[model samples]
Target: MSNGVIVRRGRYYWHLSVQALYDGKTACIDWRSLLPLNGGTTKQRQSLLASSKGLLIALVESPRDHRGERLAHSTVLNWVHDLRRLIRWMTSKDVWSFSDLRVTDIVDYMTFSTMRKDGGGEVAPHTLYMRGKLLHEMWEVRHQYPSPLLIDSTHWILKRRDDGDAVRRGGHLTSQLLFPCSVPR
Candidate 1:
């Protein structure tokens, strides 16, 4: 609405300055109380901004048949909601910087997000990989931060490892040989 959800720079909480339609008049929804996951330190705040930018880009380029019209807007808004929840969890632990975020933090969040009542919580390895890839995409586009992973393979394996499955599978489908060679004329 208001220039696509204003998350102010250098702020701790995830602020959404929304324009609401009430009684034919415009109003605002203030979510200032929602603090960021690490007190919103400089680095953390920057990371949030970077992630948001990346998500918007993905939404804009999404396939038309996938989500119907207005998919971009809807997808971006959905991402905002997901980010809000992540922020809430981070704030609870007083984490405020990218440096403060450890592999454990990511694992914990993944668990919290995908946990089933039976305690066999799991997020598909592909989904986990995509999430990290999205973040890396954001970082690359924003050009503010360096590579998220110090070593490329570490990042790849971390994203791919799920439920202790030792085999790494590729998501892409390869083309099979369909044409046969003609020898006789």
Candidate 2:
């Protein structure tokens, strides 16, 4: 608990927040620990828990989200697809493992998702938003809670062709458009 390290629970997961001081520069890092590994000998459980990859794989296969509802067919499929993509991305980046995944690696994954020769470009903003939501559902080794990765990735966005110009995002997504203003424009 010392050195500015704090562990706490969110809606369902355990969060480890640590502040690091290096070269007189300070930075904070947060990690979402996975769900507890059960149904094995102490040593076997420990071994599975020790490997972040294994932990992640278990999380992906979990039958339900943190809320305990049975995972929908599409949800499981998305998890499979995304997890595979993540593993491939990890290998391509030569990442040490899942536990060692850094925020930079996450950012890089976002970067990689946007490039392709076919109809693919970047993952849609809504898709990224949904993925962020799902991150909360999976990968809880503690209390089965939300992951900070979801919150962190919410800001992820790719540069659009009109980005340089101040073209506003469409207003249709907001409910304000549903009602007419009292004052005439």
Over 40-153, each residue of candidate 2 has an lDDT whose tens digit, in order, gives 355533332345333343453455434543333334345545555555565555543454455556556655654542756755554554444434444344233222222232
lDDT of 1 by residue, 1-185 (tens): 22444345233333333334323432222234334434556766666555444444443444445454433333445555555555676666775433355555655554565543367765554544444444344334433343232222223224332332333453432211111243111
Error of 1 at 171 (Å): 15
Model 2 gets an lDDT of: 0.40
| Residue 22, candidate 1: alpha-carbon lDDT | 29
Residue 157 in model 1: shift from native, Å?
Answer: 7.1
- Superposed model 2: Cα runs more than 4 Å off: 1-68, 115-119, 134-185
- For candidate 2, the TM-score is 0.40
Candidate 1: residue 110 Cα off by (Å):
1.0
